[model samples]
Target: MSVLDTRCVNQLYLTLSNILSISESDLRQYVIDKKFELLDIAWSEIDIDEFFKTVKSNVNRLKGNIIESVTISHLSSRLEYECNKENIYNLYSALTGETKLRKYLSDVGIECIHESDVISVFFHGERIDWKQYEQTPVVLMLQKRLGVTSSGDKCINGFLFSGDIHKNMNVTHIARIPEFLENLLRILKVHEAIYFWERNAQPYEIIFKEKFSGIIYDGDDSLSLEDKNIKTIKHCISFLGRNLFNEWNQNDNPIIRLKDDNDVLADQIISSRNLKTNRIIFK
Candidate 1:
């Protein structure tokens, strides 16, 4: 193998076991000159799974103490153990990998992951020190995967009670509430909310403030916090469909929906939508 090529692959985190044997100075120069070109090449060659494996290997092997380890399953371990069998499976499937366990995503179809899910893999693994890993473009992308990094600042773990449920809420239970109204409210902390009847939404459609982004998931089979949230949201939507249709069949009057105003995201979304008596509304 070319010394040039092996060094590039090494920088990409493909294999860390001395794929190249150049000296420290030569190694640094090799990376400085050629790493970016290799990164662009590798990005197209590798699937996300292999890329994740490379990340884990490098993190475990890194020589310093700057990696801040975080994973929803690990962070919210107790929450999963305390839940139901299906719930536990849902949680397990989310953290481990969802493409293996579930065949169909209920009403929308299995292909709906891109449409239904949001912010998948929030806070992937840990808050890695950019200074330590920035030598490699792959690691740079890993940091980006964890979140958007500004200049100079070291990345750190973030926590909050609400706002961007994609980044905050660690449980799937809230997502299972109909129209995702309840979970929506908890994230945004608004007093009112609305749910648009799209299969899965592009965040641009919900535009309001700094709280906006569009289509944040990559539709991987791997389990993630976003998977739990999406699955729960779908179940909740199905429940609403059944309950509302059934009640309408019996009484033939307009259905009055009940909701908790305390959920911030839900309130903002609902308040944004203007609903007439018989039709679904989209804002």
Candidate 2:
């Protein structure tokens, strides 16, 4: 079990955040515009003072309406019990003042273990090595952080750090989106529907039974237009209708990485037994 300390929680959050290619600074701007929020932490990152002030004005009166005001003796027990209950994270978010995110994380069943010294996260699925792949985005960032070659079928990566080497860059396989378009594939039941997206090229057709299509463009389609992305993705999913969007929103994101209880990255550590290492290593 991992503790909910600064390093662990932030690492976990970053690993799972969907805007893989986007940097934290860029994402923060979206937070400023209230396009989407990162619950509480995003506000802290941009301006700690302003965030606290906002919270004080909007939240102070609810001091007694939350778990924070409860007696300390029952805090630990209550938290543990809630953590064990299904979607009890809703309670945690209510306490933390971030209900939507709490609902989201709860659906995924990812939880932190601050109650024990080992301080770890637990998942319902035990098959993949999630912890290892969780940090791949950081590695992806490294390739851009410093100049590195990414020729051949390899991608330049920089997630691993050595006590001697600030970063260890390598050309490796990008994790193949651990889970396939399972949710979208479910849409296969209705073949008449087209796909849709807010960005990127999307497949116009499915492989008959394979379910869910990819970007439909051949060697010559634009993959970065906001409207085009939406159209392309819409082509891939038009069969499901608007409620499907909520399904996408409500669908619990399963573990898309390898999960190892012992691995930690700050000490320049990594688990070599991940999906990318075994099957996706470019060279």
Candidate 3:
């Protein structure tokens, strides 16, 4: 007979206990009964010690295959309860010591700022803050991009929704928002590029001012200047797609001041590429 890993069994038992809101003592019996029912066998048909050993062995097997573990499935099933699969997956990750959001960010040289109401990141000497909005177009775009629950308030429970893990599992407390972190990294790269252009291009101010002043200066006269402006605009548009830039020309947009004045020029520029530009920015 193989030795049982009591640690793994205890961890799994604790996890199931917390998730099901049942005491560990009662949970053990419930699991045994559930397993007996699943196997279509009476408790008297199997020796109790042997059955428990089998249960511990099954828990050991769940170390690397938690999501698909039959024991987890059995424990999670309830007549009136619907399981949250994502939460279970996160719990499994926590148990297995998987890399989570904060650690992942630190590994890639991005620092997470712990704030009360917003998700903030410090990258390339810039601190960017993302505020949560229920189901606005920007929030919808982010949720869709991140594969969070769309079409309802369920999205608010996703990691991307609050830039952290679901609030339920306070035991492990690991923050696992991989998709949001990756998206933020991409946006930060583009943001850094735009900032580089802003610092290096002497014509940036002229182009920006002229672009919004109703004075059309197509970069056809200065190819280099035109290229830089177009790249800057593209980056801004990309930010808009990520909701890092405000789509409604709101004054609170972190990036740039976009108003009615630049609407036509911005539209023409974006339209040339068959792309749509919302009132997003370059601050």
User: Which candidate has the highest lDDT of all?
Assistant: 3
Candidates in order have lDDT scores of 0.24, 0.22, 0.29
lDDT of 1 at 26: 42
Which candidate's TM-score is highest?
3
TM-score of each: 0.17, 0.15, 0.21
How many backbone clashes can be found in candidate 2?
A: 32
Residues 101-195, model 2: lDDT tens digits: 33332345533332222222344443223334434554333222212213111111111111111111211111211011112112222112112
Worst 10 residues of 1 by lDDT: 67-76
What value does the lDDT take at residue 203 in candidate 3?
12
Off by over 4 Å in 3: 1-100, 129-177, 190-283
Candidate 1 accuracy as lDDT: 0.24
Ranking by lDDT: 3, 1, 2
Better of 2 and 3 by TM-score: 3
Model 2's C-alpha root-mean-square deviation from the true structure amounts to 23.6
